[model samples]
Target: MKTKIILVIIIVLCTFFIGMMLFIKYYSPKEKSNQLLSNVSVVDGKQIISITAKGGYFPRITNAKADIPTTIKLNTKATFDCSSAIVIPGINYRSYLPPSGETIIDIPSQKAGSSMNGTCSMGMYGFVINFN
Candidate 1:
């Protein structure tokens, strides 16, 4: 019957759309907002690394110089999600970022060829800073 044929077509279309959504959500590479990324810089003998936090950390990976005073400048804008609760295990740093603002954290100079990792409180989002 025509009803049976139409039903089959509907089912096929639904399945195909669901499959595409799943593939895009799980298999795709998700990185950043792109427009918000800021370049790292040094000033007055201090290295400042800028990172944006929202749904997740932008520029999930970063590279910086080693053996210098370093400051991690975290920026958040209207961020109220779990990503706002950041945890930097390498330096034993943990805190909740403001809904919209900047938070600066300082640490001693890192050794060459070292890396530091930071993640959300729930471990769902993270970023890494590699020293060279």
Candidate 2:
């Protein structure tokens, strides 16, 4: 009788452990990583450009009419492209006033499980362009 009781207890314990493991493996919440990119255009005489970007990323525009500043929030490694062109940091990233024409800029996020926030200057006829 004692042997049978021990065996039953062992089985029950094993079953409980296995169920718990499975639950944790399949039902536990998971962390999600996402990337977002957007395109924005600031025309001459405009002070701000408000547009919704994908992947929960939003670009804040400051001084849109003069020395425009753009702020972007990123959750993961992403790439922002405009007019099929890629813009590099600290290099011609600024747009001229009366904004000669539309300038495309690309922002790329290349890391996992990371978020990035940055501010840059923009000008009229400047576009956030595209991202991935």
Candidate 3:
């Protein structure tokens, strides 16, 4: 019957739409953040870099001053993904971040033109900090 065929087509279309939505939500690349300028600050002569880690690290790229003692803060709120497992190979740092809190790692003063990179445990998500 035409009615039956139409109903089947509708159901198939709905299913396809839902599947695509789910894939885009969890499997698609992360959106870039526009908070780069606000994420870095100097407090009492020490540089502080703030990054939010949820589905992935935000701001993807951070710019900061070099040759200053620095602390990188990884903030998380209800993060249950691989991004919580942060790894910074340059400093030999690796750890599992809490689900809802902040993790701070001290970084020594870096020479200008150097950079540091952090990635999730699975290496599926990452971010970079450039010193200038």
Candidate 4:
């Protein structure tokens, strides 16, 4: 019947639109831009990376050297958001940062062409450190 065919067509279009929306939301180039303050440095053979946590982690992307002991200095100034708590699954490091201070986290030397990811407690904010 004509009505049945039209209903089927509408259902197909709706399904396709929903699928595309989900794809774009979950698998897009949202993280392609690097933040301005990567703040990565090396001293005494130790790599130190700094990140500011407020509404989100600044410098969403950072490039650093591999095969060196690393430390992450998370700075939070009057941060009362979910970003105050961070999780680094690569090192099994999870902690709640003070509302206004710096927290240091250590990471072992990583192989070249590897990456480390950190996210807020609710997984809403995040950052990435690429070692190469």
Q: How do all the candidates rank in terms of TM-score, highest first?
A: 3, 1, 4, 2
Give the per-residue lDDT of model 2 (tens digit) for 25-120: 766533211121222343452222333322222443222222343333222223242211222243344332121233333333323332223232
Top-lDDT structure, candidate number: 3
For model 2, what is the alpha-carbon lDDT of residue 38?
Answer: 21
TM-scores for every predicted model: 0.71, 0.30, 0.73, 0.71
Runs off by more than 4 Å, candidate 4: 1-38
For candidate 4, the TM-score is: 0.71
Number of backbone-clashing residue pairs for each candidate, in the order shown: 0, 14, 0, 0
Name the top TM-score candidate.
3
Tell me the tens digit of each residue's lDDT in model 1 across 17-74. 9999998776653433333344478999999999999999977999889999999999
Clashes of 2: 14
Query: What global local distance difference test value does model 4 have?
Result: 0.90
Which runs of model 3 end up more than 4 angstroms from their true locations?
1-36
User: What is the C-alpha local distance difference test score of candidate 3?
Assistant: 0.93
Pick by lDDT: 1 or 4, better one = 1
By lDDT rank, best first, the candidates go: 3, 1, 4, 2
